[model samples]
Target: MEKDKKIKLGISIGDLNGIGSEIIIKTFEDNRMLEFCTPVIFASIKTMSFFKKHFKSAINFHGINHTDQIIHGKVNVLNVWKENVSINFGDEDVKIGSYSVKSLEAATKALKEDAIDVLVTAPIHKHNIQSDSFKFPGHTNYLAEKLGGKSLMFMVTPTLKVGLLTDHVPVKDVPNYITSELIHEKIDTVYNSLIKDFRINKPRIAVLGINPHAGDNGVIGEEDDKVLRPTLEQIKSKGKMVYGPYSADSFFGSANYKNFDAIIASYHDQGLIPFKTIAFGHGVNYTAGLNKVRTSPDHGTAFEIAGKGEADYGSFKEAVFMALQIFKNREEYEEYSKNPLKKAPKKS
Candidate 1:
């Protein structure tokens, strides 16, 4: 945790059949990536060799039996699997799914052991990987559970940031999950994450209404006025700058998003639809309120474009850069808190 030490980043090679391997290979093509952190990929040497030939990437690989053997310039890969098997590119196989889960397990173990500073996960297909052994909804839930289940999903870009009140839930079931307690917990987590992780002091937060027109003043629905409004009042009493119950329809439009540091939405599509529209192929999905730093590209597994060299690496690059920036911010904030006299001027 020293300020001058390079962060030890552990990466999980998500769903080898998808574009995860391609993007991970493409991301390391930039030699400058080595300067930020020591990247260790939890995957098989055979699988990486297959990708190096298939994608025609210039990435060199180094086989290491342990994380202590990680080297820069060449991708330091831990041989998670002992057996060699044929890997059919772009084909869904349960064995590959099992292997993906194993890779993630190794990465999470390293994180828990304090062997790595941050985790950068690639995309994985939930449907293909949800067997009896690996039965989590996605990486967010799986990682949260491994880290004692105290985290929230927040999607971030340079222009906008959003935290989901309920993720991976059915639309009909979202309202039931949005209790007064849940709202308060999510708001508190987002506020603390902004200040501690992103170094934003006194962040202005906007909360989106569950119903249209903010329940049309209770004519359309009562959840916004009854559940959200009272919660905002409680948060305001604590001296936090939180506004809203704004109608979801006009909140993202009308350029209202620029006025706030973060937005809280009731469900998945309600927030992600607008965010993806604006920050498509550029957003990074961040898991805040966790003991460790974790981030992934906003996009999912691109099945159709897998292994064709057609998938874009923009979001993957953004996720890596965001992790580095947040790590730096956390370091500086810790230093400033300990020595207020050396505090730098706040950025405009």
Candidate 2:
């Protein structure tokens, strides 16, 4: 955590059957990435070598059996499993899914134990990763339980940010899930994250309507007038800069989102659809409100282009940079805020 020390970045190799391995090696292939953070990949060195040869990458790695042996300025592959598992590039094997879970479990443990300062996860296929031990919808929900905070699925870029009220929830169930408490909790999470994570002093947040035109004043539905409007009013009464139940259909088309620090959507697709459309391949899916820093590329595993070596590493690379920046931002926020007169560290 020292200012001069590089952030220890932990990586969980997502579904090997997908583009996870390909993008990971591709991102670290440029040795210059090591100058920002010490990368520790939570998969076997042999597995990484197989990927390196398949992708024809010239990236070298520092192999280690444990995290304690991690070396800075090297792509360290900590041996999570020793057996050589067969890989089918585009096939969805449940066994391959288990390996992704193993990698995530080990990397999360390291994060909690302070072995790593931040984590950038590759994309995981949601269906393949379901098991008795790991029965959450996705990483955000699972990490929420593990890290003990009201985790928010915040999809962000430098210019735009969108948070979800209900992620990975079915559309029919989204309405029932939106309650007064959920609004307050989600807005509070976004407000705090903008300040501590992004250095925004006073964040102005806008909420999207749950129903069309926010229920058209009861013509379309009653939830907007009865549920969303009242809840936001209560938040505003508390002296927080919260606005809307704006029509979801026109909010982005009119570029209204640019007016606020962040937007809270009523459901998953309502938010992610616009976010990815605007910032695909450049956005980072950041999990705000968690005690630990976690981020992933905006896109998912591209099964169609799994082994083609045609996958883009821009988002994955951005995820790494965003995690490191947020980690430092949180450190600096704490350092200066905790002590009124703490001297700023000198730049190198």
The estimated TM-scores of all candidates read 0.96, 0.97
lDDT of 2: 0.92
Cα distance off (Å), candidate 2, residue 331: 0.3
Candidate lDDT (C-alpha), each: 0.87, 0.92
lDDT (Cα, tens digit) per residue for candidate 1, span 72-96 = 5566889999787676667878888
Q: lDDT winner among the candidates?
A: 2
Report the alpha-carbon TM-score of model 1 versus the true structure. 0.96
Model 2 regions more than 4 Å off:
342-348
Query: On residues 1-348, what C-alpha lDDT tens digit does candidate 2 reach at each position?
Result: 666788899999999999989888989999999899999999998899999999999999899988899999999999999999898988888899999999999999999899998998998998899988889888999888888899999999888999999899889888899999999899999999998899887789999999989899999989999989999999999988999989999999999999998999999999999999999999999999999999999988898899899999999999999999899888888888889598643321
lDDT, candidate 2, residue 37? 93
Against the true structure, what is every candidate's RMSD?
1.6, 2.0
